[model samples]
Every structure is written in C-alpha cells, then in structure tokens.
Target chain A: MRDRLSFYILRESPIHRMNPLTKLTLVFSLILLAFLGPVEWLAILLFTTVILPLSFLAHVGREFLSATARLLLPVIGFLFVMQSIFLPGGGTALVQVWVLDITLENVNIAFVNATRILTMISSFLLLLLTTHPSALMSDLARRGVPGPISYTVTSTLQILPQMQVKAATIMDAQRARGLETQGNLMKRIRALLPLVAPLVFGSLVDVEERAIAIEARAFNSPRQKTSLVEIDDRPIDRRIRWGLILVVIFLLGSRLWLK
Target chain B: MAQVTINNLTYTYPLTEEPALREISIEIQAGEFLAVIGANGAGKTTLCYTLSGFIPHFFRGELQGKILIDGLDTANSKLYEIVEKVGLAFQNPFNQISGSKFTVYEEIAFGLENLGLPRDEIRSRVEWILALTGIEDLAERSPYALSGGQQQKVALASILVMKPGVLVLDEPTSQLDPIGTREVFQVIRSLAHSGQTIILAEHKMEWIAEFADRVLVLDKGEIVRLGTPQQVLSDINLLSSGIGLSRYTRVAHRVNQQKLWPKGQRYPISLQEATEAFGRLLSQEGGSKK
Candidate 1:
C-alpha cells in the first residue's frame, strides 16, 4: 500500500490551480449527467470529450487513467457480468452458456450501467487527482462546513494509510513467526485474527491521545477560525459553479419531462 | 505571584478506583524551566495533562482542588479557553500531529488559525516559529514524511506558535533517537534561555541538569522531592523513589561512599561540578604537584 493518503499530483496546470469547489462541482455535474441524461452514449461521450481532456489539462492524465483502471474496472466488470447473466427482462437471447442466457436488451442495459459507473467514478478520480485533500477540506470549511466534520474526513484519509501500514507490519511479523497466510480458506481466515486484533486495539488506544492532541490545538475554539493558506475562489470559479448547477437543473428537468 | 499554582490538586480518571494524582501542589514562577522526573506510572504524564487542562477537561475525570495557570482556574474554564494559555506536546510525536495538514508550515499554523489570527499575522508567526524551532527547511515537507525528531519539532513549533503562556511537554523526546533527542533538546534549551515558562516531564537527568531551573521528583502521585537541580538531582534518596540520578551525581555518590572526598561536601549534579570537586580532591592529595 502507498504511504500517502491522496492521489494529488503537484503541478502548475490551470486545472490543478482551479478552485477546489469548482472541481468538485465539475465532478458532481458529470455524475449527474451520466445518471440522469436519457441517452446511452452520453456517459461515454462525457468521459471521452470532457473528463479525459480535463485530466490532460490537469496534468494528471496518466495518473487518472491508471487509477481508474486499477480501482474502478474490476467492480464495473463484475457488475456488467452479473447484470448480463441474471437480467431476465430481455426477450431476445444473444448468447447461452449452460443455464445462463445473455440477451441483447440486458446487454444494452448492462453496457449503459457500466458506462455510467465509469463516468461517475472517473469524475471523482479526476477531482482526487487534481486537488489536495486538505485544500478541499479547507475550502469546504470556509463554505460553512463544520470544523469537526472536515477534521474527521481529512483525518480518516490519513488514518487509513497508517492503519494499512500497521496491518501490513503485523502480517509480516506473523508470517515470520510461521503463521500461514497462503493456504486453504480456513488457514487464511485464521491468520486474520492475529493481524486484526493488534491493529484495532492499537488504533483504539491512539484515538484518545490524538483527540487530546487536537483539543490542545483548540479544535473546539469558539472564535472565528482563520486559514493559513488563502484559497482563491475567483469570480470565474463562482460562475462555473453556477453553470454546473444550471446544467444539473436542466438534466433533472429533462428527466422529469421525459417521464 | 507564580504563573502556575496547583494547590492540593488530586485527580482520578473515569472508571478507575485509584487516583492518578494525589495532593500535588507546586508553584512555578514566570519564565521558569521546571522539570518533573519520576518512574513510569508515577503520574508525571497525569500532572502534565493537569497543567495543560486536559486532566479534568479532556479526560472527563474527577479532579479535586485547584489548578490556576496564569490566574485562570482550569477547573472552571473550558478546555478551549485554557488551551489559549497552555499548550501541550506529548510523548508520541506521531500522535501529536493534527493529521489534517499537508505541509509542516500549515501544521504549525493549525493552532493560530483556531485562535482566529489574521492570515498575514499567521504567516509571520508561522515563519518565525519555523525558524525558532529550526524547521524552516521542512516547511514545505509533508508532516507525515518527517522523522520522529522532525515531527516532534513540528509538534513543539505548532504549540509554540500559539504563544501560550505556559508550555507543558510530557516527555517530548521519549520516543526519539539520541540524535533526535539532542536536536529537540537544543531547540528546547533555546526556548528555555529565552525565558519561556516550561513544565516538562522527562527522565533524562543530564538534560534536566543542564536546562531546568527547578527539579521535581514524583512518586505515587506525590511530590517526593522538589528543589533546584543540584539539590534534588544529587539527593541519594532519589534512587529509593525509583528516579534515576544524573551520571555525575551517581559518580559523586560512588566517590563519596569510598570516603575519597572531603566530609560535608555538596554532591555534584553536573559534569562541571563533578570536575571541580574532583580537581579540589586531587589538589588536596598533592597529586597536582607535577
């Protein structure tokens, strides 16, 4: 596992410098369009024309494509296979493998669903790639998000990597002690107990000290909080956000009219 | 009046029968470097927490008596309010990190931002503390990527930028290596020379001998010995309470036991004093005639 919590690549690209909330707005707009638009090709079109080009503009195109391939493809692939095999509404069968029949209608439905998920997850990945987690969190807090909530989100992102490192260490130690991890399901399941017990309890112990540490920094201070890094939310950023909102509204209206 | 006055302060954690601290009273004057020494579980950390208002406030335990820091009653004030006057750094540098910041510079500014300082002021203070703590080179580095010593320095700098009236450190160098410990102690020594009121709990007697204006030895939640470094660190009875004496003091004890030293002589708690005493002994024995 990677030690860092974020996929943020530091660069001087304009997309990387865009307001974090504006990037977030772009993400939500793409997802909404993919899910609510009454067109099958819209998902792939958005992914190709907008999301792919945005990644290149952000200077994280390579990172974004690899992240999507590594993290999102398997889940979407599994969903496509399950939906094609189990979907019973289609009339014309396209293929038959033993008792499982694949039909043209179900394939179409599954293909659209898969594309929609790809667009949704790719949009999120794009945002994650371009914007740092702390920058996103600080922007959110500035926009009326609660301090503790932002703290929780950013801290969770950090804590997960540390926990994974801990788990890996325990697994390595247990393996050195000759605890079998690669074998039948029962042996592998047995290895999890030794690895998990220490990780869970150790983190639980750290939670108290971490809480006190943050409290010592005045985490619950009643004063108006100030930020050290001044994020630029230019007029264009606000206009873009407004534009994204309008697009979302249009998508919802079109869906309602078609219904 | 003293900057910190704890009067008969006793505390017991929630869901526990035994009190972690009992009848502890100490007065620390302004600009004093007071060091607390004790064996593990002897309430050194508990006392540090109480000093920083975490004992009764953050821990939610039963606290008795009063802890007055810079004239604010910690028992009545909220944790946030007390934190403005007292900043605490604990043993584990990793745990002390706020974990919400990407750069060490922002991490140091976490406290000031919470205090609502303007951005320019925050920037100036953060930069100043980064230099003060000797971490300017690490300003742009990720906090998670720092070494143990660097993280501890960042933790110390984070608390120091808030400019609290008193700084409480519960063995800040306990988890560091020798070089790391030296680096942290150098920064702390500089802070002490600048006359910052510090209440530190540590077992490194040599460092305490060099920097602390006063030494406190606790045993079973009570102050067993409290005095100047030379007085308390050289006390033979300190070992009986499970507190380790400085290396110089240990040698002094050994030389005194062998009757090689003059009678009624003061024990040495530092290398300089030991060297002086040994020099006097050598001259008295005519060994300096060469």
Candidate 2:
C-alpha cells in the first residue's frame, strides 16, 4: 500500500483551483449521464472525451491514466471476458471456447457494462486527483454537512496512513521476536493473532486519546464552524455546476423520449 | 481572584473502586506557573483532566466537589465553554494531532476554526503561534510527517492559538527525547514568561525548579506537599515517597550526610544554586585555613 492514501497531486491547474463541490457535482453528473443516457456507446464516449481531457487540464493526466489502468483495468477486463462468454441470450454466436459460446449480442452488452463502470470510477478518480479530501470536506461542512461527518471523512484520510504505519511496526516487532509470519498458512494465521492484538488495543487507546484531543479543541462546540482554507466557490463554478445539472436533466429527458 | 479553584475535589474513574484523586483543593493565581509532581497513579493526570474540564465532561467519571475557572463552574459549563477558558495539551503528541488538517499550519488553525473565527483572523493567529513556537519552517509539512518534538510543538501551538485563559499540560515532554524535551520546555517557558496561567504536571524536577512558582506533590491521590520549588523539591523525604528530588538536592543531601555541607544551608533544587552554595563553602574553608 502507498504510504499516504490521498490521490491528490499538488499542482496549480484550473481543475485544481475549482471549488471542491463544483468538481463533486461534475463527477456525479458524468456518472448519471453515463448510466441514464440512452446510448450503448455513450459511457465510453464520455470517458474518452470528457474524463481524459479533464485529467490533462488538472495536470494529473499521467497519474490518472496509470492509476486507472493499474487499479480498474483488471476488474473491468475480467467482467467483460466473463460476461461476454457466459451471458446466455444472444442469437448469433461469435465464437466457441471449449464448452462456452461467446455471442455477438452478449459481447455488446458486456462492453457497455464494463465501460459504464469505467466511466463512473474514472470520473471520481479525476475529482480525487485534483481536490484535497480535507478541502472537500471543509467545503461540504460549510455548506451544511454536519461537523462530525466531515470530521470523520477528513480525519480518516490522514489517520489511516498513520495506523498502517503503526501496524507495520507492530508486525515487525512481533516477527523479530520469532513469531513466524512468513511460513505455512497456519503459521501466518497464528502470527496474525499476535500482530492484531497489539494493533487493535493500541489503536483503541489512540482513539480515546484522539477523542479527548479533538474535544479539547472544541470539535463539538455549539457554534457554526468556520474554515481557515477558504474554498473559492466562484461564479464560474456555480455556472458550471448548474450547466452540469442541466446536462444531466437533458440526458434523462432524452432517455425518456427514446423509450 | 484565583484563575482556577479546585475546592475539595475528588474523582473516581468509571467502573473503578478506588478514587483517582481525593480531597484535592488548590487555588492557582492568574499567570502563576504551578507544577505538579507525583509518582505514577498518584492523580497528576487525573488532576489535569479535572482542571481542564475533561473529568466530568469528557471522561464522565464520578466527581466530587467543584472546579471553577474564571468564576464559572466547570460542571455547569459546557466543555466548549470550558475549553475556551482553559486549553489542555497532554503526553502523547501523536494522539493530539487533529488528523484533519494536512499541514502543521492548518493543524494549528483547527482549534481556531472550530471556535468559528474569521478566515483572516485564523490565518494571523496561526501565523503568530507558528512563529512563537518556533515551528514556522514546518508550517507546510504534514503534521503526521513531523518528528515527535515538532508534533508536540504543533500541539502546543494548536491549543495556544485559541488564547485560553489558562493552559494545562500533562507531562507534555515525557515521551520526547532530550532535544525534544528541551524544545518543548523552551516553548512552555516562553508561555509561562508571557504571563499565561499554567498548571503543568511534570516529572522533570530540574526544569520545573527554574520556572515553577510553586510545586504540589501528590501521593496516593492526596496532597502531600505544596510549596515553592525549593521547599518541595529539596525535601529529602520526597525521595522515599517515590518522587525523587532534583539531582542538585540529592548531591547536597549526600554531602550534608558527610558534614561537608555548611550547617543551616537549605538544599538546592537547581544546578546554579548547588554550585553557588558549594562555592561559598570552599571560600569559607579557605579563609579558616588562612
């Protein structure tokens, strides 16, 4: 696992400068348009034209493409192969692989399904690659998201990495004491008990201390919280958000008309 | 008027038969530096939690008596209100980080942001505290990536940025290395010099002697001694109680046992005082020989 959990790349680009909620709206709109729009090729078309170009605009094109290929390609590729061969309702047979019959209609259906999943995940990746998690949470909190919810999201982003590091240290300590972590399955399973016990209890103690720490800082203060890093909700951002909403509505309308 | 008053205070943690603290009464004046010294489980941490309004509010323990800050009882006031009056920093620096903010600067601003300060005000206060704590260079670094010392300084700055009426630190340097210990103590000394009312629970007797106006000793949740650092830290009997005296005092007590130390001379609690007393004794011996 990566040392840090954030996908955000620190670079100055138009996409990076946009408001987090605006980017969030854009991602959701793209996902909705892909799933609800009345065309089989629409998801793949949006992924290529919109998401790819936006990644470059955000200056995270290389990271975004590589991350998508590395993280999502296997799942999508597996789904396409499996569904194209096993799905049972096609009249024309494309090919025969041993006992399975690959059909033309099933291949088309699988392609649409895989590309839709790709579109949904890639849009979110674009948003995460551009926006800091805490910045997003802060904006959401300012716009009426409860304090605890936002705190949980942002704190988890940071704390998970620290906990991972702590877990590694505990594992190393246990191994040094001859706990046998790298042998037969039973040995590894037994090693998990020693490794997990300390990590869980230690994290529990950290949780209590962290709770007190945040409480001491007035985390639950009965006041409207303010943010230090001001997220710019520019007029242009508002217009873009509205424009995305309209596009989504138009896509839904078109789907209804086609039906 | 006392800035903090703990009148006949006693506390028992949840599900525990023994009380963590008993009959703990003390009045701390504004801007006075009070140091509490005790053995493990001697109620130092418990007293700190009570002072900072974490005992009954956060910990939800059975508490007796009262703790008042600036004429407001902590039991009656909300934790947020009490936090405004008294800021708390504890031992584990890693745990104190809010974990929400990425940078040390933003971490320090977390508390002020929660207080609902305006953007410009938060920026200015965070900047001022960063400079004060001497962590200005670490401003943009992630709080998680910082060393224990830097993280503790950030923790202190985070609380100090709120500008609370009183500061309560519970063994703030216990987990730090020698350099880290010095770095944290320097910040605490600066805060104390700036007339911040501070109640620090500490084990570093030598450093406490230099800054603390009074030292309170606890043994088994009872106040065993309360006096100036000289009076409390120099008491030889404190060693038997598991709260060891300062090295200077121990050395002097060892010398006094051999009749080498001058009669009627009080034991020293710091290196400078120890050297001065020994210097005087050497000169007297030189004069007698002449």
Candidate 1 TM-score versus the reference: 0.96
Judging by TM-score against the true structure, name the best candidate: 2
TM-score of chain A of 2: 0.94
Candidate 1 chain B has its poorest 10 consecutive residues by lDDT at B281-290
Task: Give me the overall lDDT of model 2.
Answer: 0.91
List the TM values for chain B, per candidate: 0.96, 0.98
Model 1, A147-235: lDDT tens digits are 99999998888778877778999999999999999999999998999988998898888998899989999999999898877789999
Candidate 2, residues A1-259: lDDT per residue as tens digits?
3236889888999999999999999989888888888787899999999999999988899999999998888998899898998887756887888988888888888889988999999999999999988889999999999998998988888888888888899999987888789989998888899988999999999999999999989898988899987789999999999999998988889889888
lDDT of 1 by residue, B1-290 (tens): 99999999889999999998999988999999999999999999999989998878778889999999989999999999999999899899999888888789888889988888999999999999998988999998988888999999999999999999999999999999999999999999999989899999999988999999999888998888899998888888889888888888888788888888688887888888889988888888896566
Clashing pairs in 2: none
